[model samples]
Target: MTRRTFLRNVGLATVAHVVGCTKVIPELAALTANSVNSNTESKSGKNKLPKWKGFNIPDYFQPDPWYEIKHTPEEYFKWVADWGFDFIRMPVAYPTYLNISPKKQFISAEDVYKIDENKVEQIEKTIYLAQKYNLHVSLNLHRAPGYCVSTGYNEPYNLWNDKSAQDAFCHHWSFWAKRFKNISTGKISFDLVNEPCYRENINDTKSKTTAVPGTLYHNVAKAATEAIRKENRNFYVIAEANNGYAAPELADLNIGQSCRGYYPYEISHYKAPWVYPDPAYQPTPLWPGNMGGRYYDRAAMEEYYKPWLNLVKQGVGVHCGECGCWKQTPHDVFLAWFGDVLDILTGNGIGFALWELKGDFGMLNSNRSDVQYENWYGHKLDKKLLKLLQSK
Candidate 1:
């Protein structure tokens, strides 16, 4: 179907080319103008999600020639299924599946819809393997058309404010919804975006972060949800929480919600360079102890997650989309804190996905200095952390 027809069917309105900082076609000017009946208290009445526990397979996380290098091995899926886990979140960057001009780091606004079928086929292969191993695949756009939580190539426009960007974002999701229409919701889900926050400067990496306004977030998510459902009404959709911290504003959209487990950044990302930016300032993390001038324990954790739990009570499905500590944190402290994190989330019927499967924050090959690693098929495994996760 043509773009105009697709937008019309989904109730999105757009105009012709609007010249600005870059050549942008100001599409989707008002996502909710005539699209959805805005109702703050109305529930979509979608079924609640099962508490799915698994890890992130970071294969297409960035635009790299070796994009498939980090993909979870087929055996890893078997391990996850064997270990009683039922979910795997694959966070992807848009450029990974697009054929872009090598000279430019960012995709030109006009080229946002162009796709490379070969790259997409690889994505399909991974999903097929995950399903073969009985794992539910949650495909996520970690970096979307015009927004990314981390420092990457500056995008051509702002996803929150740019109509063109919103148009492209919704288009990509709609494309996926149609592509995976044959797959049952029991085996797959689409996480709309990752850690969306309102930044003072959309192009600046260090810009101060704040919660996205509820109306704007709702409009964007609702538009995407509508576009997806236009293709396949049965497809399960999930929206990540505001800034990945606050409760979601999407109960009316009939979709699942996802939140973060990196509550006290001091514990979860101790010396992670991206967060700390300086090694000297990284705090020595301790569980159930005072750090960064605040005391953190099980009580603090419970308080932190109370909002998420309350969202669940309101008939919204909630999950911890990302959690776990960087390798810099001591293993004992990491385990102690994460154990509480898992217990509170799982005990409350919310599930979690560790940030990665074989990386610094994962149970396998974490490369922590304090871990007594077990050699499992040439990969170092943190059995204690594995056992802790399984127990929850």
Candidate 2:
């Protein structure tokens, strides 16, 4: 059975209905009215607003099962506000809302417009909660119709190479733009795509021209940005750097740009099953050691961030959308790396969101085996990391 069908069978329909009627309806109506005014004011002084300081709400729609968001929207938003975060980057998977299956791997542009209402409703509820808690929400398509950063889920054709894939991608984004056109640009924004990294074609470290055809990253991003602008001119659109946020070419698109802080992959992704340095090798990553022929340190991190910084100098807003060291890394090393990264991000006036808030790489209740887990709000809370994030 499909995930939607399963939810219905398990009485999620009833729960959603009750929640909508009791908590969501009134707030949603009020939010819509407030949004119109906010959007106009936000555009007037976009440059003056502080950078987004927040966390990513992972796994809600990136995977099929949707397990990461275990708490109610209210509880989650309250927790974020309580912790002093001002934004939430909510990543979603396109497959969760589409009917396409393994037997039918491709979806037409027509189907792309017919989004699952249930899924949209859940997202709206999240927006409502964000509005209630005064947190900005950045809706990110982590896994777009044609591409995903995660393995085992790539589309049959390259999103950049296939005409149909590009069209479908635009349609998907246009749907959201039209649906939430009334939402305030300050309260809600769109993150065009999660990680537009095509390592085989685009170099990760430098800015290159993506204006050429077949450059899926630039082509799709531009198309989606234009499409979204057509539906809602006031919305802030964010473009992620390619390949671990190492390339800032998309910054030329003249929208908000995002950079990641996962330099020295060995340290950031230590023992990560999906990445290099296999667990069996028992790889030990030192912070200032040589990797890929360059010595890495805080200065290296600052240099690595230069491209995005250049974009900022050109008057484009930049954000550190994803940055975190794994829990398996020594706690002290993790703190040192994170502190340096955070300093660099803040030092440049670039706002940042950690990789997460709860699970691995999270501030509260991370899955670090080395730290003693302390329960707070029904989850493990790493006081040290939490304190570090809050102080910054």
User: How well does each candidate superpose onto the true structure, as a TM-score?
Assistant: 0.86, 0.78
Q: For candidate 2, lDDT tens digit of each residue in 289-362?
A: 66556678888888877777766665567788777876778888888888888887887787888877766678
Residue 179, candidate 2: how far off, in angstroms? 1.6
Clashing pairs in 2: 61-93, 365-380
> In model 1, which runs have C-alpha deviations exceeding 4 angstroms?
1-47, 63-69, 101-104
Encode model 1's per-residue lDDT on 40-61: one tens digit a residue.
Answer: 3334432166789999887877
CA lDDT, every model vs. true structure: 0.74, 0.63
Least accurate 10 contiguous residues by lDDT in model 1: 1-10
Q: Which candidate has the highest lDDT of all?
A: 1
